[model samples]
Target: MEAVTKYSETELVLLLKQRQQSAFSYLYDNYSGALHAVILNIILDTELASDVLQDVFVKIWRQINSYDDTKGRLYTWMLNIARNASIDTIRSKNFQNNKQNRELTENVYESAGSTQLMTDKIGLRKLVHQLKEEHKVLIELSYFQGFTQDEISKMLNLPLGTVKTRLRTALIQLR
Candidate 1:
């Protein structure tokens, strides 16, 4: 932690570009939690957030030299990487299903423990809860569950275009 405070962000980035261990250690120690917060805010799943954080760091390691300091701050670069990686993870097939299973297990556990206490607590959940049943179902299966549009269509017994349209609408609503 002391070492992290030793260098400015630009200096740390320069060391990282040179593949310095101390720099990497300092970046991870100082910035990983902040990066993780951004990733988890978008992903909203612990396991997916963990995977995205790993991938984000790996990307930063690989692309260190490609970074142009003129474009933005080092923190911005890292934040962008984390966001892109988490979005990619969300778009992946495995993540969709895994996300769904995780959600279901959590919901079941929550309901079992205290149903009334968990009713649409967060802003996102509250907004999602306000959606029509079909839109809500599609959003759940596609985004949170990590199902593809085709998979969601098949699961819901709806046309492919319908699923796509609903998903688009749901995402627009979320935004």
Candidate 2:
């Protein structure tokens, strides 16, 4: 295969559409870091994040034909895939069980930092402190922990509307 550095996004995407392996190799070389960071922010575990990143790339290859240029750029579509996959990872039963096991042994000061992986992963953890108690929990459940509104409501023992309101409020605060 030739040097893919010279390939433009449009050209690379075209090659991907044609199922060229070289283009995918180029894609992984170029975009894997950014995609992995996206996964790490949600997953907060390097090994799990790596696993999710692999799944994200596989899904991308399979679903490349479904991408719509009219909707957004290729990277945006890929980023969305990474984000969704990371959220799915956190929401998995295995993840929850593993998380609980870690929490049991985790020290108070270290717990937040470990679970967050660091504010460096995403700035949300730092910004989360600025939100109200209710709003902050809602955001944590909905965004970081990948809970649906209904699931969040059930988890928090609140109505769906209240959960949605808190999340919206929390997001507005973050902005």
Candidate 3:
């Protein structure tokens, strides 16, 4: 068996920035489990989360130069990248369509009595509906339907700042 190689965070960052393959391998071996768990928390689906995890690593590799050690720890930076990538994947149209298709297939297989269970699964929407009409619309468009703030702004003919402020206020209310 080959001996395991260990690197300090600084060493790992340096080697990674230098594009050393072994450093990347070591980084993956040490960090992927934690990163995968973070992504899985957001994405929920293992296959999709795995894909996001791969994309996260690719982003880490390519964006290593942009990483500033003075700003934060290496793992924290990677964690943010993994989290953002997972959120981006879930917010993507393809992921939403695939999710809806999967839900439809599952519903077809389920008995009629389970329809209520599916409806209950939409509890988040139910909660959002309790908000004022404007806030509700923003939540539905941005969270449920995965529309970006800019898209919501364009669709509602509102300024981007207003969209962001409303969304932030809606989230604060939800919390």
Candidate 4:
């Protein structure tokens, strides 16, 4: 039987930052399952979830330098990456278009009542569409697409304070 290796979080972080393959392997062996579970909850498709899991590990390996122990645990940082990756996958243009195509096909075969139910499930998205254009864009990017405020600011070429203020106003209107 192969023996397992244990590492303190600090030791693991140090080794990972140093680009040690053994440390990465150990990290993956210990945390992949939990990280996969987190991705699965967001993605729901097993195959896609597995792909996202692999991407998450690669991201963790590459982004280890950005992980701040003073801010949070290593696992928590990794969890956030897994979650964001899953959400980003689902929000991709290809994914959205594919989902729409699938829904259209399903709706054609589904009963009228079921079609209405599916439409109702999009209530929040529909409401966001009703918001003013600026607020709507901010809400969709930050909430529906899981982008951070700073990311949205850079993408929209807007100031960070403007993004936050608009997001706050949008939430208030949503209430």
Candidate 5:
């Protein structure tokens, strides 16, 4: 194998679509650090960041064909995957237990942002944070963690009727 020179993100993505090892190597070498930074900034744990980085790359490799240049750049797509994975990992039961063990409880409601976690996310993080505790929790479970209403009800130990009522009330307040 010869040392490869520079290639634009588009060109590398094109090669990646063809499943070229060199292209994969180039993409990882060039963008891994940026993506890691994005994940680390959101998750703020070195070990977790590394794990999510690996997951992000695996997703990118598997879903490369889904990339569409007309929509956006390759890095943009990869960034979205990294952000979602980081948020997902943080929401996992493992993360919750780990937080309890470490005495460092994380609030899923508090991890919103404009760059790494949720850039331009409904333009409502700051506003949502100002909401009542019940509202904040409902929004976090439903929007941030991607949970359905029933799941949120079970997680919160609340009745399904209560969850629906709170979510509806929260939306009205937000509006």
Candidate 6:
């Protein structure tokens, strides 16, 4: 395939919607590194991050037509996909043991972003570290880990109202 450097992001999106192999190659080459870094920040393990990244790309490929440019840009949509996929993986039962192991030794609440196993995620860690403990818990469980507010309430053994309040409060504070 010839180099696809001429088209703008919009054109690339159109090509992607058309299922052009060259467009996909170009998108992967340009965006994979940044998306992979975002995944690694959430997953905190290379192998798992790699697996999640692949899934994100596959979703991007399959769901390209669902993208509405009126709502957001392509990279933004892809980032959301990567972030959500990583969160979903972390929230899975398969990773519950790892989560418990981390919880046993580290007070992830005190500085939820303090643990930086990956150098590239320092920015993400620092941002999370600034949140209050309750705010961090709500954000971690509800956003980063992709748990529904109801699931978060059950997991944290909090009342549903309390879970929703905390989650809402956390976002307001973050903003």
lDDT, each prediction: 0.71, 0.76, 0.74, 0.75, 0.74, 0.76
Clashing residue pairs for model 1: 96-145, 96-146
Number of the top-ranking candidate, with TM-score as the measure: 6
Residue range 2-66, candidate 1, lDDT tens digits: 66258887798889988999888888988999888767644666897888898898899999998
lDDT of 2 by residue, 1-175 (tens): 3462668878988999999998899999888988987677667778989999999999999999999888999999998899889877665744556567345223222444456436543655678756776776777666666657997787668998888877888898888
lDDT of 5: 0.74
TM-score of each: 0.55, 0.71, 0.55, 0.56, 0.56, 0.72
Q: Work out candidate 3's RMSD over C-alphas.
A: 8.1
Candidate 3 structure quality by residue, lDDT tens digits, 1-175:
1327778889999999999999999889888988987776445568988888999999999999999999999999998898678767765734466567445333322422233243333445445656887897787566644567998798779999999999999988887
**lDDT value, candidate 3, whole model:** 0.74
- For model 6, the stretches where C-alpha displacement exceeds 4 angstroms are 1-6, 93-121, 157-162, 172-175
Of the pair 4 and 5, which is ahead by lDDT? Answer: 4
The lowest-lDDT stretch of 10 consecutive residues in candidate 6 is 104-113
For candidate 5, write residues 66-134 as lDDT tens digits.
989899888888888987898788667446566562222234433532233443332445456667888
Q: Model 5, clash count?
A: 1
Q: Enumerate clash totals for all models, in the order shown.
A: 2, 0, 0, 0, 1, 0
The residue-level lDDT of candidate 2 at 172 comes to 88
Residue 128, candidate 1: how far off, in angstroms? 13
